[model samples]
Target: MLVDQYNPFEGKMLQILDQEGNITDEKLLPEIPDEELVRLFKIMLYTRVIDRKALMYQRQGRMLTYAPNEGQEACQIGSVYALEQRDWMAPAFRELGAWLTRGVDLKTLYLYWYGNEMGSKVSEEIRILPVSIPISSQLLHAVGLAYAAKVRGLDEVSIAYFGDGGTSEGDFHEALNLAGVYKTPTIFLCQNNQWSISVPKHFQTASETFAQKAYAYGFKGIKVDGNDIFAMYAATKEAVDRARKGEGPTLIEAYTYRLGAHTTSDDPTRYRDNTEVEAWREKDPVKRFRIYLEKRGLWDEEIEKAYVAEKEEEVEQVFADIEQNGGTAFDDVFMYQYAEMTPILKEQYAEWKAFFQERGML
Candidate 1:
């Protein structure tokens, strides 16, 4: 098994592609069909464009505080591509690439970030939870979902996406422990982007690698090259297969880097050095995947230019639509907290409306 072959405790990190984008071993390359590989690249490009435009909109005060997924595209898109339609994904807030790859609407993301509560509404067909902003809380929800699936005699695997910092949260450990003991079909995907909102990886944990933490909870752990799309896909596909076969859970620590600020409100420059950022920029995931596609004759500069232009136009229109008619409805704010709002909630919402009306601000 790939998990056994690349043992995290032994300090072995999987790297199917090097920084220069050359495949390290032909045998290690994932069996993604050529067409699907091209689609993955196109989606990754679209994700990057959306992320960049979101940053621009936030800076211009057209949106709320937003997280940027600049350098971690492969870590999300690749793993999500490995998922079958029946699988479920629970994502932390920064998983813009995964959100897009997993069939989320482009306008929904924009509306959500633009302070519209309606943006969080998703179709019943999509199996993604609303973005969990409170650290590693989503992992617990994923475990519950996985356990529920097992009880229902279904083989649908659940994957939870989190960051390196989330590993420190109590919810992280509790979720892993429960999944381990229950032998739930959960895939813990932690994007160890070398920082937990400004805390370096070394300070986050004394263990040599975050993947090693899985051993304490009784499952296999894999340390992988997050920037290498092939490695991410292979690891996730293997993990997904293992889960469906009732092999229990696996924790995958994607060793990636955050190329942008923690969020729109953050200033990475205050805590990190430019030289370090530049060094990681050389290993940018999007660039590495593009190089891989070029080598496979699936992509070129001309295709990239046209594809980027099309995505830019599409993103602009999505945002434009949101601006024109997608603002949050006043009633939506009070309706979703509970199936039926309690008297306190009703009073609070009504009191706010009365205040706004008194000031002619409603």
Candidate 2:
């Protein structure tokens, strides 16, 4: 009989703050200024407000489909805050929290949801790529950019944000392989929100844990409690530091839950039970973080009300700007694609112009 090797991959999930706003382990707490912790809490509030506004906008028919990251705010905000301004981010569609944390203007984010192509054009200096809607396609772009930085001798790392669904994509495999081979400075942040639309995580993959997938690529893969801001920040900060020191990539699987529908168009209740949603809501990132802040004397009911009102005013102003700016032009499809319009594109543009002209709408 042949002896069989018992190869079991054991990955521990890191959680600093528990469901009741208490620390699970004091030793795992990340060292950061008191003000920064407050800022993180504020960002979570901002994200939740904006996300609710998105749903309101969709209901009012002012915007198209939007993927709300209401329950996963800490996962995005904490990891993003850990990055240096010089680092690059390649985002999947539901990265509003991350973008906001990285200083992406609310107008820019709103315009993108409004279906304007110009919103995709981010400044090179901002280092945030246009949102990639094709699942894990952006991971390849992130890996390529990280490899380029290596070639150019730039000490910048790239982060790719994608959902649990993205891990099943071929692009994920290719990107991780390339990063492992070249030892590229990259971080793959997987927001394992437990659902890919109507599909539950178990249906998506048979793997025991998504983080262990990193071992096959020859790097560290950590599973962090996505609801814990401190844990998310600590994990990301450590991975970022290693990457900056040319220690290659790290895959962080943030185990979270989507407390809302997958998108504005989705009816999650048709598939998932209310009990499941309620259970996840109990593990709410914002509530737990707020509890922690309260325990530290950093927050209270009065402050919460005032801070929410202030953020609401800011959101109203963003909507006002969007209303004043108006919608995107129909010809924007052909106009933004190339620096100089190609002859073929020019002909197509003219055809559309004539079509709209004949209808007396142009």
Candidate 3:
């Protein structure tokens, strides 16, 4: 197993693909079909396109504060590709790639960032939680989902995605501790992007590696090359397989770098240097994946130009639809709070209705 071979305690990280798209660890490379690989590459490309457009929208005042997944495509896309439809996911925001892969509608994602509740109104069949803004709280929710599945004798698994900063939160420790005792099928995916906002990871904890923390919780842990999709896929596949067999949880620390600011509201230039960003840009996930596709004769400049154009057009069209018809229903804000509105809610709703009516805006 990858966890057994890549000892986090020993500072051994699993890396199957290199920057030039060469298979650095042939033994560990996941056996992915050519068609599936091409599909995955398309999704990864779409993810980057969406992120770039989202950032542009935010700057143009068309969207709200956004988190850019500029360079972490492999970590999100590769790991999520390991999941089945029956599985569940709890994302700590910034997982644009995973959201798309899980069949979330573009309108839903945009509507949410458009500051509408409709975005969180995910189709029940998708089996994914809404974007989690509260640091490590989703870990607990994922654990609960896994535990419930365990008790019900279901084959479903639960995966939670968070950043390294979340590891410092008590909920992280609490969730892992609970999963450890219950032997739940939970996969804790930590995208160690090396920076949590302006705070570098060095300040978060003194642990040699985030994966090692799983040992403390009585489970296995593995560190992986977050930039290499092959490595992420291989590691997540093992974790998912183990979880399906009721072998308990595993912690996967995806060692990667955030090549963008923490959020649209923050300025990365204020804290980090261009030299650092440039260095990470050289390891951009999208570029390397494209190289891999090219190496396999699956992609070329003509194909990239056409595919990127199509993706960008689709992204723009989706956002345009959201702009035209994605406003959160006026009643949704009050109605979603409960099956039946409370008396105070009714009063407030009526008050707002009356105010809007007075202004002829209702």
Q: Best candidate, lDDT-wise?
A: 3
Candidate 1, residues 77-148, lDDT tens digits: the string is 988888987889999999988988888989888888898987787777889988899999999999999999
TM-score order of candidates, top first: 1, 3, 2
Q: Which stretches of model 2 miss by more than 4 angstroms?
A: 1-8, 342-344
- The most accurate candidate by TM-score is 1
Model 3, residue 122: distance off in Å is 2.2
TM-score pick, better of 1 and 3? 1
- What TM-score does candidate 3 get on C-alpha atoms? 0.97
- Could you estimate the TM-score for every candidate? 0.98, 0.95, 0.97
CA lDDT for candidate 3? 0.92
Model 3 ranges with Cα > 4 A deviation: 342-344, 358-360
Worst 10 residues of 2 by lDDT: 1-10
Ranking by lDDT: 3, 1, 2
Off by over 4 Å in 1: 359-362
TM accuracy, model 1: 0.98
Give a tens-digit lDDT track for model 3, residues 234-272: 999999999999899999999999998899999888888
Candidate 1, run of 10 with poorest lDDT: 117-126
